[model samples]
Each structure stands twice: as structure tokens, then as C-alpha cells.
Target: MLSITNEGGSDMKRSFLPLFAAGLSLAVLLSGCGASSGNASQATASAAAYQEMPAATETAVDYSAGFYDAAAPAAENYDMDYGSDAAAGETAAPSGEGAAQQAADTQRKIIRHANMTLETKAFDEALREIESLVTGSGGYIESQSIDGQSLSYRGDYYERSASIMARIPAEKLDEVASQVGTLCNVVSRSESMDDISDTYFDAQARLETLNIQEERLLAILEKAESLEDVITLESALSDVRYEIESITASLRRMDSQVTYSYLNMDLREVLEYQKISDQPPAFSTRLSNAFAEGIDSIVVSLENTLLICASAGPVLVVWLVILGLLVCAILLIVRRVQRRAEQRRAARNASVQNARADQPPAVNIPPKEPEDKVK
Candidate 1:
């Protein structure tokens, strides 16, 4: 029996040993794989962080030489022309150089704006004429507003006022202004010009620079071997793309402003009535005008009163309602307080009367008689 048992134990041991060995080997292999994966992940993360940084420095180093060479000529020419013009004091250039410089100067970007105020007796006619002129000249009205006030005795004809802002082509700005002047008496006219050539060109140059950087970054992204590098490059590319879009939008706006001229026009109807002179007239004239002036004054006063009431009626009603509510609330509180005080006073008086009535009356005569008898 002991021998048989020993043999069975040996068999079991042999099987267990093999199983343990296999498990150990599997664990070791797994550990090795985990270590390698961890190392790879770390490397990827480091690479990603490095790539995510701005490429300005690297881009400058890599492309500065070629970009500068390509972009310097225009700048140099512009500077030379500007310097020559400044020194020449607006005088004509001596040769072809002057003509070229003049041409360049004329090509500069400018944003023009004009403000005009006009008054006319025929308000509606003038308004229609102005609109027609603007449309005919390839211009569109950006915004317009009209206001009118009722004339006191003028029977349905309101004194009208209008303000209009229009955008006309830069080439036709002067022509449009002259045509508008003919529509009415030009009460006041003013114009201004802004030169933004330098700013516009600067923005364009910056846009080009960013575009070049974007292309280089894309190429680098393609060659990147690590996930980290790709993420970093993608972030940088997005930022570059955003800047490119913003610059493009700004350039478009500048171009629009430069191509189109802005005009602000204010139109007012001339008053039909003439003012009476302060100087005294002859006696006959004064006597005749007295009754007419008095009636006119009374009518004017009534019109002014009506205007004030129309403007302030709602506001005054709201204030009066609020004041009445406040007054009612205050009166209610006072009444409540007075009622409480009266109740307290009545209770105190009743308490005092009860105490007096509950007290015994003194018998003074009986006590004196007893005292006398005792003495």
C-alpha cells in the first residue's frame, strides 16, 4: 500500500511541476510585453509634446533665407520710392522713375467717406430724386430713417426729415456727390479720406507667411513616426489655419471699404412760414397785426400743449398709479397701528377699573369709635 501511494504522489508532483513552470513563463512574457508597451507610450507622449510647440522658431530657421530673398525686393522698392518722393517734395520725377513712382502712388489704397446735409422745399420730390440718383450711379443705400412732425395748421402735411447712408463705387464717389448736390440746397458738406495702403499690404504679407508655414508643417506631419508628433502637428496646423482665415477675412473687408465709398446724407424740409421781424412797424401796420399775432400765439400755445400731453401722458399715468398705491399702503399701515394702540389702551383701562372695584371700602367711623373707647 505504501509503495502504491508513493507512486501516485510522484505522478501528481510531476504534473504540478509542469503546470507551475508554464504559468511562470507566461507571466514573464506578459511582463516583458507590458514594459515594452509602456516605453513606447512614453516615447510617443514625449514626441507629441515636443511637436505641439509653436513652429515659429524652426520655421524661421528653415525658410528664412529663401523667404527673405523672395520678399525683400518689393519692400526695397517701396522704401526707395517713398524715400525719393519724400526728398523730392512732391515734385515730378526727372525721368521714367518719376512716372513709375507716381503710378505707384496713385495705386495706393484709400477709404473715402462723405457727410452732407441738405434742405429742400419739395421734400418728397427731393427724396425720390436722391434715391434714383444713388441707384443710377451703381450705389446702394445701407440704411435710411425718416421722421415727421405734424404741422399745427397745415392740414395733413407733415414737416419731414430723413437720414440716409449709401455705399457708392469709389470711382463714382465725386460724381455721385455732385449729382446729390443738385437735388437740394446743400446746407453743409464735408469729406474725408483715409490711406491704409501700408496696413493692407502688411496683413497680406503676414497671410502669405502663415500659408508657407502651414505647408511646411503639413509635410513634417506626414513624415512623423509617432502619434504624439501627429497630434502636435495637427494642433499647430489648426492654429495656422485659423490665423490664415482671420487674415483673409480682414483683407476682404479692407478691400471692400477701399473699393466702395461711404456717403452719409441728412435731409430736412424747409419751413414754410417766415419769422416775424423784431423791428417795430408803422402804427397802422402794428394795429392791423396785433389781433392776428394774438390769435397765432394762442394757436401755437395749444399745439405745444397737445404735443407735451401726447409725449408724457403714459408716463404721468404710470407715476400717478404708483403714487396712489403707495399712499393707500401707508394709510392702511397707519390705521392698523392706531387700532392696535386703541385696543391696548382699552385693555389697560379695564384692568385698572377691575382692580379698583375689587378693592374693599374702608370703615373709618367704626375704627375711630373703637379707638376712642379704648382710650
Candidate 2:
């Protein structure tokens, strides 16, 4: 019986140990699975929460930042803000560029102006002269007016005036104005210089470009394959034509200023001299006139003589003074020459006497000796 009891207890012990081991293993496995499930749930909830937040909820983060910069390995510094500065510079550049472009466009315009006036004896003659000058200069009158005939206050005369607007070469505007002035007494004159070279060139360029565009459009219209293409070409051509017209009008105006010089004038006359009847005078008038004339002649002669003396006196005095100085100089020179001549004559006589004294006595001793020997 004891053996039986021991066997049963061993068996129970073995079974219990096995069950206990299995339970611990199962518990550990379940705990690990639960822990893993909880982590997964939390991760899922966090992801959902992140999704629920608005895009604006989080401020932008600059992820690239150096921690413990002093302890970090050396590296080249790159300024992250450079991109913003470059973008801002780019934005500012166009404003200055746009302003410069606007200034350039404004610089491309042209401008000009002129004026003149004259007075002459006849309106027709003045007009003719003005016309000829203007026409020769390649200009035409823009407008003109001639006053109707009206009796002058002095009965025999008439009053008239003319205004002519002529176009001439801009370079010759001054020349034309001066020429017009010769037709009459220049009553008034004014000249002005304005620079419209930019506008003139601008119009010319636009017109030329438009003309080219028109030619292209015409070619396109001719070669168009369909109604739609033709319509498109026609519309574009119309716009180009309008632009050309506008530019041409501007060019015409500039050309007018360049071609025509303006002249405004007034022509009139005032009688100065006229002839009168020629007749003989009476005896009393003649006698009185003769006496007055004789006295007038005598007075004029005396006055003329006095005037001549007054005008010539200073000149005469200057000449006499100059002549006196010259004579004095000549006399001084003559006196010097005479003194030199006298000195020369005295020296010549002294030299001749000295020469004769230097010579030895001749033959007298010989004659005396010969006489003594003979004795």
C-alpha cells in the first residue's frame, strides 16, 4: 500500500509540475502579446491624432541645427537666409529696371516750334517774296489772309496786311525767317528750339515696324488656307493698319515742322515826299531874299573858316613842334662835324712843321770848307 501511495503521489507531483510550467509559459506569452497590442494601439491613436490636427497647428521647424557647436567638427558655414535675400533682391531689381525702361521710353519722343513777322510796301509783293522763299525751301503756306482795300487817313493811300503760315526744313527755319524779314521791315521776330527728336524717331520706328508687320499680314492673308485663318489675318492686319495710320499722322506732323517755316507779315506804306508847282517870285520877295541870302553867305563863310582853323590848329602845332625838334637835331650834328674838321686841319699843319724840323741841314758847311782851302 505505501508503494502504491508513493507512486500516486509521484504521478500527481509530475502532473502538477508540468501544469504549473505550462501555466507560467502561457502567462508570459499572453503578457508579451498584450504589451505589444497596447503599443500598437497607442501608435495608431497617435497617428490618428496627428492626422486630426490642422496644417497650421504646428509651426515650421528648421531641422538642421548644430548642437554643441563648439564641440562639433569643423565645417563650412552656409547661410540658410541667403535664398530669401536673393529672392528679395530679385523682386527689387525689376522695380529699378522698370523705372529705367520707362525713362528710356519717355526719352524716345520728338518736339519742335517757330515764329516770324514782316512789313512791306505791298501785300502782294510781300506775299510773293514769302511764298517764293518758302517754296524754294520745300515748304507750303498753311494759312494766309490779305486785308481788304481801305482808304488811308491821308486820302491817297491804302492799308493792307498778310499772314502766311509756311512750312520749311527745320534746319532752314532760321534761314527762311531771315529771308522773309528781307521782304519787309522786321516788325517783330521770335525763334524757338524744341527737341522732339525722340518722338520723331519713335514714330518713324513704329511706322517702319508696322509697315513690315502689314506686309507679313498681307502675305499671310494671301496664303491663308481657310476662312478662319483669313479672318485671323484680317483682324491682325486691321490692328496693324490702325497703328500705322496713327504713327503716320505723327510722322506727318513732324515732317511739316521739319519742312515748313512759318512767316506772318504786315504790308503798308506812308507817303514821304511829293512834287510842287515851280514859279518865279515877285521883285520885293526877290530883293528881300537876295539881301537875306547875302548876309547868310557871309556868315557861313566866316563860320566855315573859323571851324577849319579850330579843327586844324592842334595838328599844325604838333607838326611845327616836330619840325623844330628835327631842325635842332640837324644843327647839333652839323656843329659837331665842323668842330671835327677844324681839329683835323690844326693837326695836319702841326704834323707838317714837325716833319720839316726833323730833317738835317744840307751843303752849307761844304761850301765854307772849300772856300777856306782855296784861301
Candidate 3:
């Protein structure tokens, strides 16, 4: 009984000590939380005070001193309020600026003219000569055609007429055309030039506008303040650059075309015939020529046959050694390709022989009348 009572007393003591320690820890935690809350309140108040000071200070400060310190001090000390009357003068100056602008807008027109005509005995020859002339003139033939009459024997009975379209440098148009005409007889020729000054000036103005837009876009890109703004400006700059490039390319092409002139040449070579009667071979000569051709044909045939036999001799021997085994295979494929061909022809002949062997002999009909009489 005494041991039991002592054990119970010890357990009670241990439980009471733990409850006391737990109460003390709770009290310490509450105190720290309260202190942290007070400090946070004080910091909030300090931040509010800092924010409130700026506007009050600016209002209380002397306006002139603020302004001078911020914006006007250097000008005041150095008397450096430098000014320009560009805006004022702009209204008064109606002088040469407009004329200069107009002058810049105007473009000089370059005009070129070319003409050519050629005559020859053969239209094909005339066409070839014209093509050569154009090439020699640092030009190209743009168009060409042949016409008139077909010859049965020579395969060209055509009247042999041609027209050549070509391009050459504008300054050298006349000289090139004259040189080209020397290739044949010139029947007729004409050349004309038209000035495109207005068209050129208009294109120049548009090009200038594109250039200005390009420069403006570059400036905008430099001054971009936001990511979105930068993206938008970059896209716009790309478009502007594309436009500038296209315009420049167009300008160059137009300049090149205007600097050169087009030439259209009408050429005809009459069908000149050599007298065949005068050029006829004698009978002995004809016979000799026929004999020569026959000899040539024989020689060619002999050479070809020799080459074929030489190439195929070994293959033929190897095929002969395997010929029996391959015969059925060859027959199968051959029959498949051409049913009425040689292999099928042999099979058909064999079938006819078999049918003839299987056929019975014909019998006499005298028994039919005798059977009728007995009935």
C-alpha cells in the first residue's frame, strides 16, 4: 500500500511541472507578438511622414530660387538665352527655297532611238546575222520570227523573212543600227524618241518620301521608351526599309531602260536558187556515187555484225550450256507476253496432233435404213 501511494504521488508531480512550463512559454510568445505589432505600426507612421514632406516643402520653398536652380541658373549667369528667328523668317522667306525644292523634284529625261532593216538571200542567215549584230552591240534580241514558203526538198521553200527586236544603249542606237544594216540590204528604217521627264520626277518625289519615312522610323526606334513601343517601332522600321529597297530597285530598273533604246529590224532574204541543171552529175558520176554508197553500207553492216558477235559470243556459249534448263522458263515468259508467238505456235501444233490421234474413224450409215425396214 505505501509503494502504490508513492508511485501515484510521483506521477502527479511530473504532470504539474510540465503544465507550469507550458504556461510560461505561452506568456513569452504573447509578449513578443505584441512588441512586433507595435514596431510595425511605428514604421508605417514613419513612411507616411516621409511621403507627406515633399509637397509641403515644395510649396513652402521660394519659387524663384527653385526655378533658377532647376532651369534658369546657367542662362542667368552667362546671359546665354540664345534665340533664333527661324519661325519668323519662314513666313517672310518665300524666296529660292521653293524653287530649289522644285528643282530637286525635277528629273532630266534621257531619250534614245534606234532603227534597222536588213535584206539577204536567206531569211535564216539574216536572222543569225541580226542576232550577232545585237550581241556585238552589247544588246540582246528580244524577239525573232521566220516566215514565207516551204521547200519540199530543202525543207525550206519559205520566202525567208524575219523581224528582230533588240535593245542597245541609247547613245549608240544609230551607230549600232547602221552597223547592223551592213549585214544585209536596208529596205526601210525609222526611229523616234519620247521624253519621260514627268514620270521620272514623280518617281523621285516618291523615293524621297520613302527615304524620309525611313529616317523618321530610325529616330522613333532610338527614342522608344517601352518594350511594346520598341516592338511596334521595329516592325514599322522593317516595313519602311522594305519599301525603300523596292523603290531603289525600281528606280535603277527605270533608269537602265530609259538609258537604252529598243530596235526593231525587218529583214528578208530572198530565196536564191543555184541552177540544179548546171550542177547535175553525169551518168558515170552518178553510177560511181551509187557504187560508193553501196560499198559504205556494206562496210557499216560488216562492222556492226562483227562488233555484235564479239560482244555476244561468250554470253551465247553460257546461254547454250544452260539452254535446256532455261527453255521452260523462257517458254513460260514468252507465252505470257505473246500467246500467238513462236512458243504458243508450237503448243498449238502439238494440240492439233493430239486431237487428230484421239479422233475415231467415221462409220457407214447403211444400218439406219435396214433397222427401219425391220421395224
Candidate 4:
């Protein structure tokens, strides 16, 4: 009986131990799941708190309005002052003398633009040099349009001109401009700078905030239990992703503007460099100009007359032949009329003489009496 009781007690003890072990394991798993859920909830809450949308900007964005509009949610949603609360990934400006330098270095986002109108006697050489300069300076020609006559087209000269838009490293902008200036006569030149630091940082901060929101939304989506909850989370996730893409594109565009400087140049092919002077023309200049114009007009007239004669060869010959035939016909008609008049006068004279001869005796007596009276 003692042995049986001991066996029963040992069996019960073994069963109790197995059940306790199983319960402990289940409890640990349940606790882990609870902790994970709690941590996810806390993270989602934190992200939400960090990226609170402004009440003023709650209106729907009009994407067609373009990027310059007030619809930039990323720029508006970020709350911290840029000067005081340095953004998460960015290091704050150093405490002392280096502060100004550091601020200028990393905080400044300047876009430089230059415009120039140049005239060159040698267009091909100048164009080749400019292209070389752009390529050598690690730049690219954004756009180039040439609108003028080629040598073959014009027959006299290659008067081709080009409008070029090039992008190069900002530091090399001045150097390139200077080099180009040396290659041609600069009729006009202008330079400008734009500071977009505020805009840039705002977009960057907004992007960060949006990324946080996206990750949180993705996490919530994974654990979404109901179909409605899943749909809602997915919709939110898509919006977040879209916002991310838009902001990213804007930032990239800004980055390109900031990193590369814009060089707008108009290259004209010319035979002479235009005089660029602030002073009005002198009397001598005016007189010379007038004389030159007069000479040019005369020369142009002569050239035009020659060209007309050459071009109208067949027509001119036809007109000349018609004029000669007209003159000959007129002369021939005049000659025939004169001959008929002469013949009529002669016939009258001959008839008068015959009549005088028929009356000859009376004529002699009258002539003797008239002669005596005349003496």
C-alpha cells in the first residue's frame, strides 16, 4: 500500500510539473504579443504627434496649381523653428566663430543665373570653344537653338547664331563666363542670385515627417485585423507615399537649381564688333554714318538694276523687238503718205501748165503790157 501511494504521488507531481511548464510558456508568449502591440501603438502615436497637420492647411491640395502654391503640406506641417531646433539629421551650427561660417556653408542655398549676349566674327570657333568649356567644367548644354543662315544657304557667309542654355557647377559659373567673354564681344551681361534656404529646409523637414508617418502606417497595416481597418490604413499609406514622391521631386528640382548654375547666352555671328558706348554719337560719327548709308543705297540700286536685267533676259528681249517693229511701221506709214502728197501736187502743176499753153497768144500780150508798167 505504501509503494502504491508513493507511485501515485510521483505520477501526480509529474503531471502538475508538465502543466505548470505549459502555462508558463503560454503566459510568456501572451506577454510578448501584448508588449509588441503596446510598442507599436506608442510609436504610431508618437509619429502622429510629431507630424500634426496645420488647421489652416486642412483644405484639399490643388495639384494643378503648381509647386509654388501654399499647398505644400510638408513645408507647412513642420512646427519647429529652423534657427533654434536643428532638424533631426542635420548638425546644429557650431557654438562660436564657426557658427557663421557653418551657417553660410550648409544653410545657404543660392541659385545663380547669368544672361549674356555675345557677338563673334568667327562663330564656329566661338561655339566650339563654349561647348568645350561647358564639357570641361563638368556641365551640360540644357538647350541650344541655332537660327541663321549657313554658308551654303546664304552663298556669301555663315551667319549662324545660337541661343544656348547651359548648366555648370556654381563655382565655375564666373570662370566660364569670363572665358566666354574673352572669346567674343559681350554686348550685354547680367548676373543674379536667389536664396532658397527656407524653402529647401521646409521641404526636407516635411519629407522626414512624412517618412515617419509612412512607416507607422505600414506597421499598422500589417497588424490590421478588420477589412475596413485594412482599407483605411492602405488609403492613408498611399497618400503618404504620394506626398513623399511629390516632395522628393520638388527637392530634387531645387537641388538641381542650387547645385548647377544657369548660363543663358545668345551667340551672334557678325562681321564686326558692335560699339558699346554710353555716350551719344559724335557729329563725325553721324556724318560718316550718313555718307555710308548714301553710298550703300547707290550701290544697292545698281546691284538691283543689274539683277533685274539678268533675271528678265527673255522678257527684255521680247520688249525690245516689239519697240523696233513699232518704230519701223510708223516710219513706213509716214513715207507712204508723203509720196502720195508729192504725186498729187505734181499732177496739179502739170494740168496748170497745159491750160497756160492752150491760152498762149493772150498770155504773151498781157506779159508785154505788165512788163512796160513794171519798168
Among the numbered candidates, top TM-score falls to 4
Q: When superposed on Cα atoms, how far off is each prediction in RMSD? A: 22.9, 35.5, 29.5, 19.8
Kindly list the per-residue Cα lDDT of model 3 for residues 227-339, writing each as its tens digit: 65566656665765675577566655656666557888777655553233537898999999999999999998998798789889999998997996789889888877896
Give one digit per residue, the lDDT tens place, for model 2 in 257-303.
Answer: 44344444444432331223367778998899999999999998998
Q: In model 4, where do residues sit more than 4 Å from their true spots? A: 1-106, 151-158, 314-375
Off by over 4 Å in 3: 1-107, 111-117, 147-156, 271-375
Q: Estimate each model's TM-score.
A: 0.48, 0.37, 0.41, 0.57
Ranking by TM-score: 4, 1, 3, 2
Clashing pairs in 3: 120-269, 148-158, 148-159, 149-157, 149-158, 150-157, 150-158, 151-156, 151-157
Q: List the residue pairs that clash in candidate 4.
A: none
- Which sequence of candidate numbers ranks them by lDDT, best first? 4, 1, 3, 2
> Which residue runs of candidate 2 sit more than 4 Å off their true CA positions?
1-113, 122-124, 150-158, 208-226, 268-375
Error of 1 at 194 (Å): 1.6
Worst 10 residues of 4 by lDDT: 54-63
Model 2: ten consecutive residues of lowest lDDT = 71-80
Write candidate 1's Cα lDDT for 59-133 as tens digits.
Answer: 222222343234222221112123223322332211123433353355566889999988888888888999998
